[model samples]
Target: MRVGLYPGTFDPVTLGHIDIIERGLALVDRLVIGVAINRDKGPLFDLEERVAMIERECAAITARCGGEIVVHPFENLLIDCAREVGANVIVRGLRAVADFEYEFQMVGMNRALDASIETVFLMADARRQAIASKLVKEIARLGGDVSKFVPPMVKNELLKKFA
Candidate 1:
């Protein structure tokens, strides 16, 4: 079925993420949004909250784009998560050269672990390239408007969290 896994913490799904998912869907029949359960990062949003947020955002995209989007949470190795999701490809969003460097190492490590699964990188839309979850949370915590970075629902959640 050509399933693909797109893994991230997604503490708060940003417009940049939506852009990647929308584009990534074109390459695979089912795109699984793997929400990484990284306790080390101490995300602003809990795993359930992040999953719900991604579900909401992806639902809208699915309605319009006519593709299957599933949100899955995992704490194990990304390749293992891909295996669990029955994904043969891993999708990633690249914002800049810095992102590419990190992703390069990850792709190498993942390939070493499992050569059957492939990693695909989609460049973020130029306008949304600078938008990042960390920056979005920082702006929201500092009382700055994050409407441009995240959806209204996510923006509201961020405000409520910091309030």
Candidate 2:
């Protein structure tokens, strides 16, 4: 079966992320959502909390998508995580030109690590393109409502954490 890896910090998975994952699920037999641990950009939610939040959000989509998606957390190199999961493809979401440039570089690096792994970019829904975890967190921390950007579980967690 063809497996694809979708790796990201997922500080808090957004609806844009869900849209890409849902759309990407159609292209591969199996998709593993890899929640990477990034030490450079400190996250508001810890890895465990971020993983749980992603799991809850992805569970519904996985069920609706016929259970071809799996959510997992990894604290290693993305290519290593992809290899571990037996993935031949890396799925990414493209929001803008800037994203494309950044992802293109990362894709090249990943390809250098594993020549067999290919990167696939899915454009984010126009409306959701502007929504990102970092922006959401910033807004929530300042007492702005982010109910529309993130899942309910994530929204609650953000509120609790920021409150």
Whole-model lDDT values for every prediction: 0.95, 0.89
TM-score, every prediction: 0.98, 0.95
Give the CA lDDT, 0 to 100, for residue 148 in model 1. Answer: 98
Residue clash pairs of candidate 2? none
Q: Residue 61 of candidate 1: its Cα lDDT?
A: 96
lDDT of 2 at 91: 94
Name the top TM-score candidate. 1
Which consecutive 10 residues in model 1 have the weakest lDDT in total? 39-48
What is candidate 2's lDDT per residue for 1-163, written digit by digit as tens?
9999999888888999989889888999998999888889898888988888878877798778775878778888889999999999999999999899888899889888899989999999998989988999999999998988998888999999987
Error of 2 at 106 (Å): 1.1
Model 1 lDDT per residue over 58-82, tens place: 9999999998999999999999999
Top of the candidates by lDDT = 1
- Model 1 quality (TM-score): 0.98
The clash number for model 2 is 0
Off by over 4 Å in 2: none
